[model samples]
Target: MNDKHFDKIKNNDGFIAALDQSGGSTPKALAAYGVPETAYSNDDEMFKLVHDMRTRIITSPAFSSEKILGAILFEQTMDREIEGKYTGDYLADKGVVPFLKVDKGLAEKENGVQMMKPIHDLDETLRRANERHIFGTKMRSVIHEPNEEGIKAVVDQQFDIAKRIIEAGLVPIIEPEVDINSSDKEKCEDMLKEEILKHLNELSSDQLVMLKLTIPTKANLYKELIEHPNVVRVVALSGGYSRDEANEKLKENDGLIASFSRALASDLHADQSDAEFNQSLQKAVDSIHDASVNKK
Candidate 1:
């Protein structure tokens, strides 16, 4: 692990940029950026378009480590280049830590939850990420309702994978997102928290992990999780919230910082001039940064 990057993540007052939209979410992300499905004929073309979008965001003067401590990248993005440098190297050069999304998307819904599909050749992916200078990894599972058995399974699967990631020398961001639209969202959050604490307690003092969670329905519901000795940092996902709503909710939670994807790109369009693009991105970054570092 890069100690400097580790220290920055530990101490920086900034939010992480979630640029890790993979096969499942890429189309939505592209469409939001004003690129339609008709623009891409194949997966290669689609990925290229998204890569261009990400490159624009990464190279923008507004996207700096000063207010953006880290960036979570899709595996393809990590493999690609930004201005002739590998994405991870480019990010690190710009003083931003790089994290790779390691999940192979979620499995079919079962027991009111969607667990991550098996990550085939995960060790190989981790090897490549490490070679590319990735600082950490993020994997996600989803809780659709308050099913205690299912939530426990989700958390168990996450922690099990996290240990492997840690042994390979990369911090893991365990993301068990509770669907914001669920009727019992708050109950789901509560159940999820309990399961997470159980696993966190089992970790050795030296085992540090990060968490990327959906913003809870109740403000500061994760206060104990944030303060857990085994946790390095706790971050919030926008989870379909608009930028304004996410920021408002974020400010109500003191220690949780943002790791927003859709919300971060909500104002950007592919056709916008560089000046306009940078301005919009800057505004979003500034708002998220304030919400991250300043509590209400």
Candidate 2:
């Protein structure tokens, strides 16, 4: 991304609604919407369900304005349009930036940690993102505990892809999600933070990176990260928290904002009334927004 595009993202500082659910995530969300598993016996059927959900989100009034600065879209939803216009164009028209998820999902454990599968054809993906007028990209890899070796592996691989993403002209949101259920949460956060600093300390003066981390047990645990020269913003994922629980925890952090998917769309389902769905979405957005900007 150019300086102007990067500035656009940095200047907003608003919550990002992560709607980038892949194949594995799509079924779970659809099941919650009352769609039976037997219905998705085929890929086409599953695609339709995902498409409908994304269309609902893009067209929702709650997502149309400035309250959401950006959204991370799945590959399938990347090409879909709203009102005969491209999805990215649709978002831009409504004053919301659009980002694409480029990772090929997670691979099996390596060194006791799950790593993000390498992008199969990242150059082409970046080309597609550029064609779609996307502003940035997000990729996820999980850190299960405070294993130093595992944390180092995750951090190294994340930044390795980040460099290519930056070279391709898209800002990268590096997500090394710490398992929220881990008992050693505090130690995990510290090691992860240190590993992050190791990468940031090596960045060129012109480089800027964003982080999407699990909210640490201690509020303001990422203060140094938020203030880092090469780090533009720090956002939090809900991980497995409920809507209310996520908002409560998010409020405790001074600088982190929400980039949540489940928390943002918690109670809304395909079966709900449009009014009901919108109400839930609005509630999620309002609570998250209020908590993120309301410093302790």
Candidate 3:
């Protein structure tokens, strides 16, 4: 969060509206919430996870359906992968935009060019984001054991995909996922900045509007975020992040969206019930809601 980007994004309201949160609310959270841990074990586990999450997404106070456009529609990503949850038309009816994540898994061929097909189902995804005015394509650049070539490839392919997604009309939420593979915090931050610059060089400034990252919670990380600008509206991931981290990211700015998943489902890691997951999500949701109110 460099000062330049922070101020840049903070200056734009439309950019803030571009945030799309499609993560968290797991079946594990459900079990811990009190639906009985058994609900998630048998043949019915997947079904229950889906059903409970959907119901809670619309009804729960934790979920700000009113403020946010539902995620891109899908079972896995509707929460994480951008499932939108609602059908494209349904989203339109509610006056809420849809967001799609375009990822073509990864390369499988041993000697093939390792290109990811984010816009794999191009025609359909284009129709969804464009015709529907879906917010944009929030890209994921995975840094899993990534060497220089791998990192560059991930950045290159994903950015190229971002270019296409924007040309198609949706905005781009460039997410360079930083995890264990990213090594240390300095490396993680540097790589992320590099990827953004690379992406900007190709996509230019006008076509992009979002920065979706799961920033780390270390104190230095906090200082690092303080230095960034809000070039794109910010949205922090739900899990793998701490409140301190989010506060640092959003304090320099506002109008950002944060996913309320893992943090909400903490106990669920131990494996709880549907009721438990709901409760976790509920708490997570409330935390965000409260933050929003405070921001007001």
Candidate 4:
């Protein structure tokens, strides 16, 4: 695992864990699974979670590999109250980077106009980045079926958002999730790609970090990006589905999947045991990996 191949993981495919609350639990979990960093969304529990994860991500057996435990922190999902100074102090001493999901989130209505509100205050986000100066973030750069104005909006926002986040010293992963639940797979494929190319074409080297693609079976074509000409980092989407659906997506490359409600929510819907649940999920990914290799 010299530095060269380690660089292949720039964003393409490798395991990424969504550690919603149990960041501390990832060291053992990742080691046992033979995966990469486990991510946590900085929410009400971040102080406890980040503290635990930052410690283990460094000491974990995989540290030499440079794949630390990571998380997706959106002010909405993580915590809106975490200010810049507080985050900076915490992350710097821990010596780990976090992926902030930078969404202004929904706007707060004021007067007759809507006031833009980021999930966590960008001021705080910048503060956190400045403190340790090595954090990562994911920004939503595009959406589905956009009209001319919509496409323009995507391109315009990337430039503005990236500029601010970079000033704060954070790595940004761009997520332009195209809707995947289309009535027909073929139409969905064409639209998905057209939308992807549009935003990608507009991205400046500094504005776009990693391209996050939706890996649901909108059509198997959606899965083709696993080999798409564009080598941006791709993350799987929920697709308004179940855990089985998400694990199925992981089949492409065990290293390139994101587990959301589908992964953890299985416990809520099924009577399966922990071991049984994992085995079933592993089996799906194994099958997908085999197929992906065979296709090549």
Candidate 5:
């Protein structure tokens, strides 16, 4: 692990940029950026277009470390180049820590939740990420309703993978996202918190992890998790919320910072002029930064 990048993540007062939209989410991301599905004919072309969009964001002057502490990249993005440098190296050079999304998307819903599909060749993937100067990894699972058995399974699966990631010399952002629109969102949050604490307590004092969760329906619901000895930092996912709504909810929870994806790119468009695009991105960065560092 890079000590400098670790220190920055531990001490920085900025939000993480969730630019890790994978194959499944890329189309929606591109459409939001004003690129239609018709623009790309095949998987290669589709990935290329998404890569171009990410490149533009990474290169933008507004997307600086001043308000963006880290960026999570899709595996492809990590392997790609930005201005002649590999994505991870470029992010580190710009003082923004780089993380890779390592999971192979979620499995079908079962027991009222969607667990991550098996990650084949995880060790090899970690080796490549480390080679590229990536600092950490993020994987996700989904919780639909407040099913105790299912939620426990989700948390168990996350922690299990997280241990492997840690052994490979990378911090893992453990995300067991409870659907925002779930009828029992608060119940799920409560149960999820309990399960997380159980696992966190089992970790050795030196073992550290990060948590990326849905912004809880109850304010300060994760206060304990944020202060847990085994936790480095706790961040909130947008979970389909608009930027404004996410920021508002984030402000209600003091220690939790933002790691938003769709919300972060909501204002950007592929056709915008350089000046307009930068301006819009700057607005997003500034708002999220404020919600992250300047608590209400």
Candidate 6:
């Protein structure tokens, strides 16, 4: 990324929002939001529905405000048009940096954990990010517990891809999401921190990275990460927490900001009245924004 583009997003104090749902999840997410199952019975129909839903979010009142500094989009939605302009361009016009989800999805488990599957066409993906004017990218891998081998596997994969993304001149949000209800949550977090620091230590000062971890079980578990010189910012994922619960968890951390998906869009439903949808979305935005800004 160029200095001006990088600084534009890096300096943001507002939270990030994840709106990227892959093809497999598109039908389910629409169904959960009360879109009739019949409306998205096939891939073609489903893509349109997902694109429409993304449109709703981009055009939502909350999206125009400073509370949302950026959004991560699915490939299908990132380039679609909004009011005669591409989606990413539209977000930039509204002062929200656009990002893309570049991972293919999780791979089959190995060593009792599942790591993010590599993007086979990463060069093309990064080129697309640049062409679309996207500012960053995010990929997810899941850690079940504090297994040393498993953590190493996940971190190495994430860092490998992150190096590629940084080389492509876009930020990478490395997400090794620990299951929120894991019994060894605290230990798992410590393992992640150590591994992340080890990888970061090898990078020169010019290379930077971003993190999107699950809400730590213990308060300030990510403090060192937030303060690390090579880390641009640290944000937390809601995983499965409700809005109120996620907000509370975020409040306990000193520097982590929200980069929520489900928690950020928790109460919005397709069946709701327009006023109700707006009310719920604004509330979610305010709660997350408040938690992020209060840390500063």
Of 1 and 4, the candidate ranking higher by TM-score? 1
Candidate whose lDDT is highest: 1
lDDT tens per residue, model 1, 1-296: 78999999988899999999999789999999999999999999999999999999999999998999999999999999999999999999999999999999999999999999999889999999999999999999999999989999999999999999999999999999999999999999999999999999999998999999999989999999999999989999999999999999999998999999989999999999999999999999999999999989
Better of 3 and 5 by TM-score: 5
RMSD of each: 0.6, 1.5, 7.5, 9.4, 0.6, 1.5
Total backbone collisions for each predicted model = 0, 1, 49, 13, 0, 1
Work out the TM-score per prediction. 0.99, 0.96, 0.61, 0.53, 0.99, 0.96
Once fitted onto the true fold, the runs of candidate 2 whose alpha carbons sit more than 4 angstroms away are 2-5
> In candidate 2, what are the lDDT values of residues 200-244, reduced to their tens digit?
999998777899999999888999998899887889999999877
Write candidate 6's Cα lDDT for 128-178 as tens digits. Answer: 878989888999999887899999999999999999999999899999999
Worst 10 residues of 3 by lDDT: 12-21
Give lDDT: candidate 5, residue 95.
Answer: 91
For each candidate, the alpha-carbon lDDT, in order, equals 0.96, 0.85, 0.48, 0.43, 0.95, 0.85
Q: Write the per-residue lDDT of candidate 4 for residues 102-139, one digit (tens) a residue.
A: 56542433222122234456667556544433356665
Between the candidate structures 3 and 5, which one is better when assessed by lDDT? 5
- Candidate 2 residue 260 Cα shift, in angstroms, is 0.6
Give model 5's TM-score versus the native structure.
Answer: 0.99
lDDT of 5 by residue, 1-296 (tens): 78998888888899999999988889999999999999999989999999999999999999999999999999999999998999999988899999999999999999999999999889999999989989999999999989999999999999999999999999999999999999999999999999999999999987889999999999999999999988989999999999999999999998999999999999999999999999999999999999988777
Task: Write down the TM-score for model 3.
Answer: 0.61
Clashes of 5: 0
